[model samples]
Each structure stands twice: as structure tokens, then as C-alpha cells.
Target: MPSEAPPTDFSVARIHETVLQMLGAGVLPPVVQAGHPVLRQAAALFDGQLNAEELGQLIHLMRSVMRRAPGVGLAAPQLGIPLQVAVLEDEFDVDPEAAAVRGREPLPFFAMLNPHVRPSGTASVAFYEGCLSVNGLQAAVARPENVEVDFTAPDGTRQQRSFSGWQARIVQHETDHLHGILYLDRAELRSLSNNAEYSARWAQPDIGRARQELGFLPG
Candidate 1:
């Protein structure tokens, strides 16, 4: 008789267990990874479905989870919510030169609901980006350096803001999630690298060098 096939691994079950653990701890919802159906569907508009109090509570929970993840930004889709919402924050604490080079600066925490963005200028920049949903992989993506966004604030106020550099990139990345887009979909596939390989070979943010070494198009 043929040898028995190797036992099937249940890695997805382990992922579900981790998600349950996070939920049990009263933390934010577990991040849904790539290939999840929810991540691929366009998120619905918030409209008036949630009252101010309900919206506030949701934003608070999202903010808490974002801080716990220690990420610069998080989107509703990442948390398995199909609503157009996101939170972002940044404290520019890197080397002064690096900060200047990347246009990194301190950003107060903010929430965006039903956000939409338009390119503010023709200039574009390419940098390696990783996503919480698409864990353990990074790739170079070219995006407009500046964008103007119209969005609703957490307190039920309409706001429009212009963002550039790293902030612009963060906003674009998160907003894409609302529209069922992933950074990997826009990335230069030739530049894809595992997280460990990225740290070892392309940790520094040098777009030109990355293009040259990784066989990607210039920004």
C-alpha cells in the first residue's frame, strides 16, 4: 500500500486562535490577512448608520488597537470591518537626516471617515512599503508625493487637508484599503522581499538603489 500522505497542517487554525486571543484580551479586532474575502470587497460609506456616540466608541477602540500594534496607521478593512474608516498617527523620532530625507514629521492622531483623495501635484516618490494585512513582505511602490483629501473628522466635522511625504504615503495606503486595494497590487513585483530579507538587504530607504538592485522601475 502507498504510504499515508503527510498530515495536513492547520496553520490557518493557528491564525484564528491568535485572533481569538486578541479578542479575548479586549483588544481591537484581529487584523485580517491577505486573501480574506472581506479585505477584497469595497467598504461601505458610513453615512448616518452610527450615531455620534457610537462613532466615538469605534474610533476610540481603533485608536487603542493602532497604538497597541505600534503602527503608523490602521484601516477598518484591516480589522475586518467593511466601513470606510481609518486612524493615523506619527511621531518623527528617526535620525534627523533620515526624517528630513523622508519628510517625516510629528503628526497628531486623527481619524478619517468616508475619505477621498486627489493628487495634489505631479511629483511621485517610490519607497518600500509593508502592510499589517499583508504581513512579512515589502515592496517598492510609487505614489504621488502630495495629495489633498476630503474627509469627515471623528467629531462630525467635514475637513480637507493636504498631506505630503510620509504622511501622504500613509494616507494613501490606508485609504486604498477602503476601496479594496492592496499595496501589493500597486507594487513593483520585482522588488518584493520577505521582511527578513528586506531588513538585511534594503532597510535603508534609497529608492534609486532599490530600483537598481531590485530590477524595479525608477520612481
Candidate 2:
């Protein structure tokens, strides 16, 4: 007789249990910091890797963590899950003058799964960007001004959307995480600044001043 097949691993079940344990403890794990091997590895696509209930649990955990971090976006890889999922939201509350200068606008909260983005045009804008995983430092990154994105919704619905300005930047930043790309990979390295210095000197709505001072051209 043929040997018996190996026992099922039930990976999804195990993941579900782990998620519930974290939720049950009432203390979510800290965001994984930079330098973790997981942070550099490309994330796997979500194709029923997690069931509906497990997906909701994971998303809830991510939302809570992102809000606590006070960031506009969070990726699954940032939490060490290595899935192509992220949550992003911004009130877009900058003053009118600053908002107009940056083309910043509000983005309602939504969770994107397996998002793919394409630049709308050749135009690019540069701005200071930060990440929870990278922590404590911000750098100027140039990204396309607008993009068309196709993603699966939290409900497993296929969706396509367009984003411009600040929102466009956020989408690209998070999508890059899924591919193991950090903003630093595309940043003007000389423009890197601690949050304090960023607020003090490079805090303008435009990067023109930082560009002149840091001696690097935006892409």
C-alpha cells in the first residue's frame, strides 16, 4: 500500500488562533521595526490564505495599530504577516494654503488587498515621507502625482480607483511595502531628516527649499 499523506498543517487555523490570542490579550504586538528579514522579503498575495473571519481579525489589529502610530497607512509586512494588504486613511487637515500647495486632500479609510498601481502620467512630486516600521526618520521621496490602482476589497470585491496628490503618495508608499521596497530606496538621501529637523527646517509645504539646501534634485 502507498504511504499515508502527511497531516494537514492547517496554517490558516493556526494564524486565526494567533490573531485571537493577540486580540484577547488586549495588547497588540508592536510594529516590526526596520532590519527584520521579513521587512525586506516580498510579501505573498492573499488568495484564501486567510479566511474571512481571520482576515477581519487581522485587519482590525492593523487598524488599531496604525491609528496608535498616527500614520496614514500600514502594510501587512510592517506587522510581519507578509501579505499584500494595507490600510490607509487621512483627514487631509492641512491648512488651505498648504493643502493647495501640496494638493493634499482627504482619503476615507479603506483596506486594500493585493493593490497594483500605475502612474497616471509622467509627472512626479517630491515630499517628505515616513513609515512606522522605519521609525523616527523622514525623507523626501518622489512619486507620480496620480495613479490608477486595482485592488481587492476587504470583502473580496474587485475594485479600481484613481488617486492624486498626497493620497497618491500614500498608496505608492504602502504598495511598495508589498514588494519589499522602502521609500529610502527612492528617496533623495541627502534630504533625510529626523522628525525634529524636518519640522524645524524642511517643514515647508514645498520641497523646493529642502531641495536647494540638501543639494539633490527631485526625480
Compare the candidates by lDDT and give the number of the best one: 2
The TM-scores of all predictions, comma-separated, are 0.85, 0.89
Worst 10 residues of 1 by lDDT: 1-10
- What C-alpha lDDT does candidate 2 achieve relative to the native structure? 0.84
- The global C-alpha lDDT for each of the candidates, from Candidate 1 onward, is 0.79, 0.84
Worst 10 residues of 2 by lDDT: 1-10
Candidate 2 residues lying further than 4 Å off, grouped into runs, are 1-21
For residues 96-135, write the lDDT of model 1, one tens digit per residue.
7667877877888999999999999799888889898888
Which residue pairs collide, candidate 1?
none
lDDT of 2 by residue, 19-135 (tens): 566667778678989887666777777788777987898888898899898889999878767778899999746788778888889988999999999999899888889889887
